[model samples]
Structure formats: structure tokens, C-alpha cells
Target chain A: MTIEEESGYRGKAEEFLQVFKKGAEFTQDLLRENERLRYRVLELENSLNSATAGSGPDSQSQALIQRISELEQEKKAILDRIQQIEDENQDFANRYVEIEAENNNLANLYIASYQLHSTLDFKEVLQIIMEIVINLIGAEEFALMLLDEKSGDLQAVACEGLDRDEVPPVKLGSGLIGQTLQSGESYFTDDLESYQRDILNPMVCVPLKIKDHVIGVLSIYKLLLQKDQFAQVDYELFTLLAGHAATAIFGARLYSDSERRLSTIQGFLDLLTK
Target chain B: MADYNILIVEDSPTMRQLISFALKRIRGVRIVEASDGVDGLKKISAEKFDMIFTDINMPVMDGLKLISLVRDEPNHKGVPIVVITTEGAQEDRQRALALGANDYITKPIQPNKILDVAKQLLKLA
Candidate 1:
């Protein structure tokens, strides 16, 4: 072995050892720098968390949210209340209209009753009955038939929308009108839309009665063109006419007979005096 | 004294009474009745009327003829005339309108309808 060769190998080994030591020192410095940077990043994250906790979702905002929710509920309740009031108002309006109609019907009944007994003359009573039939009952074709007690037949005394001769005598208990008079009950057709005039089958037959003693029958063959059906007030008028008309007619007839007798007596007295 | 003077021309006393009764509901209004169109025309000639309600089937003179005659007069041309027609008498209603009737109410009249017509014609509240 040569000494020079051994010495050169030993110097190269020392230089290699120095370079390894320097590399270890640089690795240690880099690890220290990395640990310091990691701690600094952790501190900054913790501060950010603290700042967010301080600023977000405070007590005032929670109260405001609850208040807003309550306000929404209150608004909904108010809207519901308004709707209820509107429904009630609509009902009241409808009721008002109905009441008005009823009032008018009552007024019509009052007027009809007042006019029926406004006169006592035979002709005037008949005229009033005709008017009542035309205006109140809305009868276009009708006849007032008085029963001939001895003959057992009803003879038409007055007629409207028809000639007096056109209305033939109705026998007792024969047709609708006669039956109504015999029974002392009124007869009315339920459906008048398809009604066709038949003398035996009248649209309406009201018996003129005085305490269950029927004297005549008011036969309605046809109604006014506008009146296809009778109203509630019409039935009321019929009821009124049944009693008041009978009394009025009977009184008028008695008055007429008495007047005629009085005139005859006056004439006799005048002849005796002359 | 009345604020308005209205006339009703009808043959039936019942109808005249009904119309008068309805008209009485209005405040400060006077109602005058005539039995026929001829009588109505005489009254109209004598006095100025605010409104007139007439039946179409009146005797002596029909409502259409009366409306035409009233329109012929210079003073009564502006007066409002309302005709009462039967439900099926559309021809009569049209003729009345053509003859210068302002409006028409049907027979079997509701008093409210009459008042509505009166209010509209008189521009009342």
C-alpha cells in the first residue's frame, strides 16, 4: 500500500462529512421555519373564527325575525277578518233586497183591499171587481157567474175579454168552476206555461162565498200575456176578494133593490097626492 | 208646493192609484192623474209637466198618438215620457219609442221599477 494514496482518501472522506453536516443544518432550519409558519396560520384562523362569532346572527336580528313572523301572522288574520266582513255585507244586501220585495207585495195587498170596498153601487162594485181581476189578479179573460139557486146553474153576469154570450151557463157540480163553487174552495192550475183555454178547465176558479155559502164563481180562463204564474200577493188578493167581494156584492144588491122599492113607493105616494 | 209635477195617464183607477202611491215615496213630488190620453193632452196643454207616465192601451187616444202629439209641441218636446206596455207588446213599446217616448215600463209593474224610471228621468238621487 502507498502512503500518498491513503492520505488522499482520508482528506476526501473529511470533506464529504463536512458537506453532510451542512445539509443536516439546512434541513433543521427549514423544519423550524415550516413549524413557525404553521403556528402563525393556526393563530390567524382562530382570530377569524372569533371575529365571525362576534359579528354574525346577533340577538337583535333574532328578535327582528320573530317580530316579522308575528307581523305576517297578524296580516293573514286581518285579511281573513276582512273577507268575513265582506261575506256578511253581501248577505245583508241580499236580505235588504228580499225585504224590499216583501214590502212591495204587502203594499199591493193593502191597495187591493182598500179599493175593493170603496163603493156600494151594483155597477160600481162590478166595475171594481173587474178592475181587481185585471190589475191585481192579472186575469185577461174572466167571468163572474152567479148561481141560480132554483135552476142549479151558474149564469155569467159580467165578463172581461169575452162577450157575455160567449160564457155559457155552468151547471152546478159539473165542471171545475161549478165544482169550486159547490165545494166553496178555490181551484188553481199549478203549471200555466202550457195552459190552453178550456171552458171546463179554467186557469183559476175562485168561489165567492159568505160564511161557507157560495153564491158565485169567478172563472179565469186566461191570464195577462205577461203573467204566466200567480204571485204570493195574488193569492192574498183572492182570499180578500172571497169574503169582502161577496159582502160588498150582496150589500150592493140589497141596496139596489131597496132603492127601487123606495122609488116605487114614492111614485105611489105622488099619484095619491095628485 | 212640489219640486216636480208628474202626470199619470191611465184608464184604470186602480193603476192610477198604484202609480200615485209609488210616486208619493219620492220627496217633494206632485202627481196628477188623467183617465185617458185625451184628458192627459188637455192637462199637458194647460200646464208644464216634468214627467209623464202613460198607458199604451188608453181609450180615446193611444199613448203612441199622445207621445207624437206631445212631441209636436215645442214646449213639451223636452218633457220626459214613460210608457207602460204589456209584457208581450214589444211592437207597442218600439212604436212608443219611435214616437218619442223616453222610456217604457212593462205591465205588472213593480213600484221600485217605476221609481227607478222616475229618478232617472228627473236626475234625482
Candidate 2:
């Protein structure tokens, strides 16, 4: 494709992105309207709490009764609309699942990338990565380790299933995690039989990379009890983590460093004054 | 105003809290919570509740079974039962209604929906 055609394609993509963002906003509005109608109906119903057939024939009570019925009908219509929108959302989620199962790896990759880097907070970003692995990848017994550049070891930074205290820092170029760090590539082995003997052999190891350089490794120790085996989406998520996770980690780390520097400066000012 | 005793049967603490929170806004409601269907059934047998709000998916027994058992009980024949279900499980909701649930609500449970439905079904009906 020519550069001109590439720019045109990029323009179309941006238009589509804006359209979807607008659609999300519209969905939010519908949700709010649905909530308002719901409250309206509830208020109308609560107003009739004192109504009984013995005292119901009065003009004011008759008006309340008519208004209650009208509100009920209106509520029904609003609920129907809400249900339709919810059905569409459910359909989209179902299709997403199907694509994740069949051949929607690219979409999965995009979503994983979007979610991982969507936050600037380091802890939240790590939490999102962990959720993606557990919810999307269907894995358990995982440890996310960052490479200690000066010490040449992998330190356990975030973990689940495996106790953080029990996990010793692994030497660089020692095992599967080390191998992924050195190679700057993802390595996944479903060889359950072989992994039984090698305690350090993670069933899956994806190196977090900044460009070609490996920064950290997410080691999946095993599949969860409910999940029998890994699927195509898991590998795509691994690839996404390999690329986008590094950027998010670096961004968060940079923010934390700046915050720490500011705190240190404030401390120095206070100490000098004292 | 007559007092209404409502039993909430759900395993997830967050969901139970949400349901309780929504129900508490209405006047004349006394809410009791059971973590699972088994616990709900035991409560149903031991005490008298004006209404039952149950979630479908639980560890020991589900809402359908709870609904069936509640319907089967001679004492609780006319009690109002509401089925709380996930979005994808329309079939289960239908089954619960068939098993004699008075109404249904989908999850990400809306506060107003619960309030309106509870008022419509449980109060002055």
C-alpha cells in the first residue's frame, strides 16, 4: 500500500473509533433513563401504598390510580427497551467469546492491550493484567516476576496461588523464567508430565518486553481447576503481555519514581527548616 | 402499614449486600439473608417470611430447586418468590417462574427495579 492509502486507512479507523466511543456514551444515557423510569415507577407505586378499595372511590385516589397504571405501562416500555439493549450487549459478549475461541485472537490482543495500558496506577495496571490472565486466559498458580537489572535475578513482584514468601528469587538464565528473560520471547509448555519433576518449570512463561529487550516474565504455573487446557486466546494474551505489559509497567514505574522524588524533596525542605 | 419479612438467598456477599441495600429503602420490609439455597430452605422451614428473593447460581442448591421446594411446602403455598438471574440465563428464569416464582430480575441488580417489583408484588397485592 502507498503512504497516501495508509493515511486514508488511518483516518477511517479513527472515525470508527470515535463512532464507538459515541455509542458507549449513548448506552450510558439509555442506562440512566432506564434508572429514572424505574425510580418514577417505584415512586408511583409507593404513593399507592395506602390505597384500599373501601377508600379508593375518592377523586384524588382515582387520579392516583390512573397515574399508577400509566406509570406502570411506561415502566414496562422502558424495561422492554432496556432488556433489548442488554440483549444486544449480551450478544456482543457472546460473539466476543466465540471469536476468542475460534479465530478472534487479534481482537483479543487489542482488548488485552487496551485494558493493560488503560491505567497509569502501577497497582491497578498489575491488577488488570492479573484479571486478564485469570478471566480471559483461564489460568491459576501464576507468578509475575520483574527482572532485577543490577542483581541479575527475577524478583516476585505480584502473585496468586503461590505464596510470595515461598517464592525465592530466581537467578538470570537459570530456568524457564530465566530463559524467557534471556531470549525475550514467550515460552509455553503444556507438557504436564515433564513439568511434574521440574518444580521451577512454569507451564507457560511470557517475557514482558520493551521493544526487543525483555523486562519481566509472567509465569503461569498451571491451568485452573475448571479449565482443562489452554486455548488460542491465551497465547494471544501472552503475546499482548509480551508487548503492552512492558509499556504499562514502565509508565507506572516512572510515575512512582516521580512521586517518590517529590516526597523526598518535601522531606528535605522540612528537615532543613527544622 | 403491614410489615413484610423478606428472605434473601444468595452466595455472593456483594450481591446479597446489593439486594439488601435495595430492599432496605422500601418501608415495612424486614430482610433476612441466607448464603445458599440450602440455608434458604432451612430458613424457609424454620421461620415465616412474607417473600423470598433468591439468586439462581449457588454451591449446594440453586434457585430453581429452592423455588420448587418452596412451592411444594404446604405452609408457604401463596408466598411471593422472586428469581434473580444472570443475563444469559433466560431459560433458568423461565424455569424458576414455571416452578412458581412470582417475578424475575436480572443481575447487575438495579435498585429501582428491585424496589418497584417488590412493591408491586409484595405490597398491597
Candidate 3:
């Protein structure tokens, strides 16, 4: 009875060992296959990374970045150019305004000269001269004096802001007015701000000349309250008046005398015909 | 291209011409000259003027009187008046303003100044 039972137990133990060996072998094969598959997956991932970095996405992105940088530079340069053009335009606009002001001053001179010679009547000529003095010269007190050929003295023919008696006869080469007439050059005060109303001593004296020959003198005793100093155009006006006013006055006097003689001759003719 | 009629009342012909030359810078402005306040009044009565520039020391009726008379007329109630006065005559300027002058400009005026006053008063561009 003991021998048979021991033999059965030994056969069963051998069958169990065979099953355990088969299970261990299958586990080892699975581990080996897993390791090989892991390596394959790593290789595929690296190839994909290299392919993308070599020529596809990375290069495209780099080109796009370079293009953006270039565009930014171009935009900055364009903006700079635009700013320069704007500055130039502003300069031109300012110059245009300056020119416009200069043009107006020239027009004033032209108008003054044109008006001075527009009349032939003696009263009208005198009135024009007075207006030229007050408006153009900005003189509040002034006198226009003509030289007396026989007496060798200057007598005021037209006086403003003063009575005729206030202006006495000035001997040639005696006072400021006489010196202005003698030299045939303009005389201006040293300091216009300190000028006051003086009938004897004038602030400015412009000799009326015809080709370097002084015929009369324009004496300005006081300027207007608004006029502190002479402007650049005022000197031009003085020069113009010196020549034009003298010629205009002389021409007007001659025309007036001739007109009166013509009237007298016409009257005599009428009387003879009658 | 005359749209506005402006009257300039001045005693001196040269002053009138100068004022006219200055006023001509304004676009669409027609200028009318008058010798004195009396003549200005006559012209104002005869025609419809948009504005008036007058001297303070004009002969044959002062500018203040002319302004008052012009303001008395209902048709001229809206008309603007600018007085031209000497720089020293501040009292005259004030009197003119009190008598219905809209503004005042001193003598020895610049053409640009005259244009500015006229453009502002006339509402011109």
C-alpha cells in the first residue's frame, strides 16, 4: 500500500514543474518583444523630429521671422521720410507768409508814389503833399518850406499842427532845416523816442530835391504817438517823396499858372471877338 | 464778385485811397468812399451798406454823430461800424464806441491789421 501511493504523488509533482517552466519562458519572450518595440518607436520619433527641423516647419518659421524684421525696418524708413516731407512743407508755408507781407509793403510804396503825381491843381497838390506827410511819414507836426530865391531864406508854404506865425523864416545854412537844404540829404533825430513837439527844432528833415538840387525842405517836428521809430519802408518813402514830391509840386505850380494865363488869354480873345 | 458793400468815410482823399487799398484784400468786398460824415450819412441813406469805416475827426458832422444817426435807422441797426482814430485820441475812440461803433482802429494802421478787423467784422473767411 505505501509503494503505490508514493509513485502517484511523484508523477503529479513532475507535471506541475513542466507547467511552471512554460509560464517562465512565455514571460521572458514578452519582455524581449517589448524592449524591441520601444527602440523602434524611439527611432521613428527621432526621424520625424529631424525631418521637420531640416526643411519643413522650422525653415518656414525662420523665413517668416526674417520677413517680419525686414518689414519693420522698411516701415521705419518710410515713416522717417514722411516726417522730413512734413517739415519741408511747414518751412515753405512760413516762407510764403513772409513773402506776402513783403509784397504788401511794396504795394504801399507804389500807391504812395502813384497818388503823389495824379493831380495838376495847386490846391490838390498841396493837399496830397500834406496827406503824404501825415499818413506816410506818420508826422503829427510838420511843415513844407520852399526856398526864397531872392531873399536866400526858407519860408513855410504849408504848415500843420502849428500856426503860420509859429514858423519863422530860416536862413540858408543857418539851422537844421537850412543845413538839410544845403546838403540835400535827409536828417533824422538821433533818438526818436525822446523827440517832442518843437516848432523850431524838427525831429526829421527831408530835403525836396530835383537831381541833387534842393528846392524845398520837409520838416517833421513831431511824429505820431504810435510811431516810436522809423520803419525800413519809411526811408524808402522819404527818398521817393524827395524826388517825386518836388517834381509834382513844381509841375503843378507851372500848370496852375499856365491854366490861369490860358483863361486870361481866352477872356481877351472873347473880348476882341465881341 | 462783390458781395459786401463797405463805406469808408474819410476827409483826406489819400486816406480814403489807402483804406480802400487795404480793404480790397478781402474777398467779395465792394468799397464805397465818402468825403465826410455828412457824405457818409447821405450814402448810407441812399444804399444798403454792410459795414462802415469812419474817421473820428471828419468834417461836417462827426463820426460819432453819423454812427448814432445810422443806428437810429431800423434798416441799419445790424450794420457794423469801425472807427479810425489817432493813437492819442483814446477818448474819441471811447466816445465813438459809446455812440454805437463796433470797433476801433488807430491811425498809422497796417494793411494786415485793417484786413483782420474787416474780416472779423464782416465774417469773411
Candidate 4:
């Protein structure tokens, strides 16, 4: 559910909690009064025996017994209502906790999405992609590699928590990352061969596709200590970023290219003017 | 070509490199770099610059304060200032322009566009 929808349910749950809490409090108060009445019943019964043995019971004593029985019935009903409301409140509290967790995840997704498109600057896009991987995905070691379209090679553009010198360029149809990108498939570490898994351990390589053509790869190397394994939500995020991130990075590359040409022309124009 | 001294104020090394590299494509332009607004303010006070390019959301101080502070200086009035900011930050862009920033561009900065504005502001070709 969306955050807005969850918040609406949360409001109703809070109101429900308050009403049940009030009902429980009211029932407790009645229980205290009922206990006091039961003690008073003992006194009335003692007096009734005396009056009955003396050949006439006061109407007030008989009336007191009837009132005690009525209060007993009311107390039983109140106790049942309190128990039912308490159970419902407990269930509501659990559901609210679940919604809270979902809301937090959704918020994380929103922030990541916002940051991904925050800039079109080539260098800035690289930084943002790194931040999104580290902060949002909880990956300590990750690499952002761009596909050299002309050479059909995967070259590491940016990396974190790993050695840059160790990142060898991969040809289009090579092992792991390259193979997945060539086939337009996502590769998870669980399906990796033992020898092929030495590098990018426990990694997920998502292809950056624009117009269904894979342009780059976002490879997550090592996960954070807190995260044992990737979750369903991580897969969803991977799917989201594959297209959006690739498109942005491609645009940045094109922008930078135009920028270089413009600078040359502008410089030439300025020299002529001078 | 007019020899111009430009100050690039940004937090990222890569962004600084990109801007500096682009500026170098033109002739007779000297570029100085500062990491954030506080450093930018210090440099602005220390030396004369033909133009200033700054970014928002930095540690210590921010671009908005830097622009206002630079505008408040006696000898720095009417100098051209360009703001490099995030794409979705229109409110900030408008605010910077209102605060006497001469022009603004969203990132990724098209280098030629910056050169164009620089030429107009400095009355070059």
C-alpha cells in the first residue's frame, strides 16, 4: 500500500485503540465498585437472617439482594466486553506495525528514485548511483560499469569498497556480468559457479537498458552485515533502476559530448571576436 | 581571447574536474577551486575573480549564503555569478537568481552553455 493509504488506516487504528483503552478503563472501574458491593452483600445477608428469625425481614434487605444480583450480571457483561476489545486492540497494533514497516520501505524507494534523477551531470550521476547503491541497497562493495558500445566491453566507471585496479574490462559475452548483459538477463550470486564467484561475491548484476539495449551494468559485490541476503524488495528496486538509471547515464554521456563540441565552437568564436 | 579568472565552488572532486576541464577548453581562462560555501567565501574575499560558479547543499555553509555574502561586498557588486544546482530544485534556482546570481543551470551542466553565459556576462564574444 502507498504511504497515504497506510496513514489513513493508522489514524483509524489509533482511534480504535483509544476507544478500547477507555472501555477497558471503564470496566476496571466497575470491577472495583462490584467488589465493594459484594462486601456490602455480606452485611445485608447477615442482617436478613436476624430480621427473618425475628419473624419479619425488612423490604430494604430484600431490595438490596435484588440490586446485588443485577450488578453481578452487569459486571459479567462488562468483563466480556473488555476482553473482546483488548483482543481487537492487540490485533490492530500488530497490523499497524506491519504498515509502519511497509511505509518505511516505500519512503526509502521514493528517496532513491528522487536522487537517481537529481542531476544530469555525468560525474554527479555516477556519484548519485554510488550513493543509492550504498545507502539504499545496503551494499558495501559495488561497481558502476558502462558498456563501451563501440568495443562491446564492460569497463568499470565507478567503484566503492573495492580495488579499482582489480576491475578488469569484460568483453560482451564473457563470464557473469557480461554474459547477463549480452542476454538481457539479471544474474544473482545464488546461481553463480564456484570459480566464477571469486570476484563480485554474493553479487547481483542488473543490466542498464535503454530502448531494450543494455548499455551498462550495476553490480553489487558485498552486502552489509545487517542484511543476510537480498529480499524481494531489492529485486523490485533492481528492476526499477535498470531502465531509469541506464537512461539517465546515457543522457549524461550525450550531454557531455555536446558540451565538449560547444566549448570548442565557443572558443573558436571568442578567438575570432578578439 | 579575454583572459578571465573564474572560481568554481563545488563539493565533489569529479564535478570540479569536469567544470575545470571544460573551462580549460577556452583560451586564457584561469580557474580556482573551492570545496564549499565557506571556502568559496574565503576565496572571494582573498582575490578578485572575473566570475563565480557555485553549487548548493555543501558542508559548513551553502551556495545561497555565499551569493548573498558576495553581493553584500563593496568591491564585488555586479560581478556575474552562475549557480549549478540539482535538476528538481526550481525553488532554489529562483531564490538564487533573486539573490543576485546572474544565471543558473541545472546539472549535468552543459559546458558550452556556461561559456555562453560567461561570454554575455563579461561582454566577450
Q: Which one wins on lDDT?
A: 1
Chain A only, candidate 3, TM-score: 0.72
Q: Sorted by TM-score, highest first, which candidate order results? A: 3, 1, 4, 2
Ranking by DockQ: 3, 1, 4, 2
**Local accuracy of candidate 3 as per-residue lDDT tens digits, A253-273:** 889889999999999999999
- Weakest 10 consecutive residues, lDDT, candidate 4 chain A? A192-201
> Mind giving the per-residue lDDT tens digits that candidate 4 earns over B22-91?
5765678999999999999999899888899898767898999999999998768878999987555788
Give lDDT tens digits, candidate 3, residues B1-125. 57989999999887788788889877788999999989999999899999999997878888889989999988788899999988888899889999899998886766777888998998874
> What TM-score would candidate 2 get against the native?
0.45
Question: How would you encode candidate 2's per-residue C-alpha lDDT over A15-100 as one tens digit per residue?
Answer: 99999999999999999999999999998887786565345668677899899999999999999999999999999999986753
lDDT of 4 by residue, A189-251 (tens): 764223233453336889989867999888777665455666665777788688778877988
Q: What's every prediction's RMSD, in angstroms?
A: 9.3, 40.0, 5.2, 31.3
Runs of candidate 1 with Cα error greater than 4 angstroms are A1-58, A269-274
CAPRI tier for the interface of model 2:
incorrect
Q: Candidate 3's error at B22, in angstroms? A: 1.9
Under CAPRI classification, how is model 3 graded?
medium
lDDT of model 1 at position A162? 87
- Decoy 1 TM-score against native: 0.79
**Superior by lDDT: candidate 1 or candidate 3:** 1
TM-score-superior candidate, 1 or 2? 1
